[model samples]
Target chain A: MKDRPLILVTNDDGITAPGLRALIEVMNELGDVFVVAPDSPQSGTGHAITSNATIYCTAITIDEGDQIEYSSSGTPVDCVKLAVNEILNRKPDICVSGINHGSNSSINVIYSGTMSAAVEAGIEGIPAIGFSLLDYDWEANFEATKKYVKKITQKVLDHGLPEGVVLNVNFPKLKEKDIKGIRICRQAKAYWEEDFDKRTNPNGKQYYWLSGKFVNKDKGQDTDEWALANGYVSLVPVMFDLTAHHAIQKLNSLGFNEK
Target chain B: MKDRPLILVTNDDGITAPGLRALIEVMNELGDVFVVAPDSPQSGTGHAITSNATIYCTAITIDEGDQIEYSSSGTPVDCVKLAVNEILNRKPDICVSGINHGSNSSINVIYSGTMSAAVEAGIEGIPAIGFSLLDYDWEANFEATKKYVKKITQKVLDHGLPEGVVLNVNFPKLKEKDIKGIRICRQAKAYWEEDFDKRTNPNGKQYYWLSGKFVNKDKGQDTDEWALANGYVSLVPVMFDLTAHHAIQKLNSLGFNEK
Candidate 1:
């Protein structure tokens, strides 16, 4: 028999999250699975690493499986770091984060702990993908995601991703048949319109709750937002290189170097 | 004074950091300045926002100046959100974040709260820039940065940045005369080789201190890494669009849509 691909599974929703459990089951069918995930929920952590503090990890078995699991008191990105540098004896063939309980589409990826974990794995030169369901409920059905996730993971292992790139796969909240297949799309231009709910505490100290409406102004059919809104699973090939290469010429034209 | 252009200033090192005070002093020369910064340091928070809890902001006077400052109990990105949505009476002509206490030259931008603040402002459709010095000390002399900061900020105010773009400027640790001007460069390919210091805590539990050595493998002379190493201030125009556009066609060819 051909050797199974060694797959590292992780999530930002903590180890016991149903989304992560669903991912683990899917990954188990495809490879030798090992999980190193955050011990607590770490949503919206972005690409934060544990720099200013110490991290602690402990082994746990959430299910009877061939997979070994370790839960860490760190952010999702830190989990990737610990897994690669401390836990894994050898580099895994692939890493998959999330099956996140909420959308990580469009501009949401910038604030996503799920995507950040995948980005960390990508930074370490591993083929990685972050999977998120559009549904936010903890009990959201993930059966529709398995087939698509497997196909994408298999394709990644088959073809390999471009340098500095990782797959950000987000599924619509729909039945398997209702999911109108996958769309390779660009990140949509969208932003959160923050509304701070200012309130006075019992001690008379004021505070504000961060709440927002996601505003998607781009009407481009080729955008992830368009795909997700139209019931298609969106797969945006995200890159870690944040440089605006086109702006270099414009900045150079400003005579910054002449000084 | 023809209504000195309104400028918003902020930093990840908190309101009291000398670096921010230096930036505020610089902005005061060219504009009517408003400051909204974290009450405590939020250095490596990345693009994190205060979604899980309430944020608090209080007005404070750090120095005698025409500029007004508010200290927020939130991440740098939260400061930007609150500033744009609640604090600023009008949309500032430009937003500037940080005279960050350390280099945000290459991959450091991914982990920087300073750059994240600027990026948050850029996302809100304001022209923005993040400035950093190579020195990590709180008392690092920032006199060398004032001229360049003014020049760059003026240039940005003169010619607005392209949509979705922001400036990430980093200075080498050197005297004003030792600085070799500025270079518009691309973000260098670099990463941290993490050295986790695993230790047994007093309670007999294992813990780790996150520390790392930055490794720059890219030899491109046009990279930010090269410019900084060569004593030149590096200016990398950063974009919030994380899409790997080049990979879209490759992904499409995989029959993702046909399935």
Candidate 2:
């Protein structure tokens, strides 16, 4: 285990984002880091890939760093695919995404490009983790997140993740000392209650601004939303297999075969 | 159940696509249909929503049909959100997406806008199903898929879907007489073996076109890929909860709280 591990780092907030830079700095200390991320912000793009068009990626240095980096004209998921299929000579020991500029707790994970990038890596049999800070500001302090990031990344590299699983980790916006310990939890049953602000355009056409309120309906203590709200970093193990195995029997009983 | 059911219909291949129109026709026989679909093809958009910009939607009639329709300048998931939040006066009994022009069985589901629309509807507590045929042509014949689509949809309407679950149905590209009966199966373990075609642009920059071959590594006959290949309509009960519940205990054993 003395050999240095190969690490792939990426984020949904684009290559030049402070959140990604913070992630790169933390990962640089642990292993050889290669960054393949979007050229522009792609926050809620989910698991989207660039299938309808061609993607352009450029090799460039963003700062005084040892990490090899590429800026992709594609989504976060596309970046991961491109990294694994086009850029890297070998599969990395671990893939880490984000240290994102906002929260991806509970239902928010469904619409997150950060988690999607990690999930993409996981689908390709790589141990992966997606990290998010509970702050949306571009200049939000990532100082308190560094140690935890290092700890979790080290633990995952030491002990590979279970089959078909990836980690969705979120940090509460607290100072290093003030933050509570990390908690292993499930995703809470929460949703964004949307409120579409409708308006008319100069061309007399109708348009809408999709805004929503985050509504956490679950009262369970063993959930990510509860952990994050209580100032702990929440880690939820997520998978790509979306099968509802328990419901299969009931669906089978409906007897579609019956005349 | 004597009152006519309200059915919300949509697709990733745009509102006027032949596949979407076929779905609408089949749905029309069972209930009052309302269409809210993308204005253009949105394949591979996954669970993306319109978060970074304004979305424009307009009411239009694509055919001499009884269904009311709207085309939105957003992704497939956005069409669902728009339909439920702004377009429909009351919640539809069921939401159906696609009869998509390509196969969305196994690993393809992760990157499919067709499944994403259905998954979005499931999240909103609406019973939903996404249908696809194993053909990618714009003029693919959907005649053999109609009977199965009708039966599955009718069954769903009669027996409500379990909470957090939706259905993914795929038919083989066979003649009506050659198709076998429908089979209930799990999603197959599969992935795309990506082959990125690198090219030099006129500006002397390199670009890549994402292409891949569908690789089904699993030999299990109880999987969707197997069922589809065997000339059957495959139905897999899909869920919105991404939590890997089995990995929770393993993750908890990490003891991140130890002093």
User: Can you tell me the DockQ of model 2?
Assistant: 0.83
Mind sharing the TM-score for model 1?
0.98
lDDT of 2 by residue, A1-259 (tens): 3398999999999999999999999999999999999999999999999988989999989999889999999999999989999999899999999989999999888899999999999999999999999999999999999999999999999999999999999999999998899999999999887889899989898899988889888999999999988989999999998878888788788897665
* Residues forming the 10-long window of minimal summed lDDT in candidate 1 chain A: A250-259
DockQ of each: 0.82, 0.83
Per-candidate RMSD, Å: 1.3, 1.3
Instruction: Compute fnat per model.
Output: 0.81, 0.77
- For candidate 2, the lDDT comes to 0.92
- At residue B119, what lDDT does model 1 achieve? 94
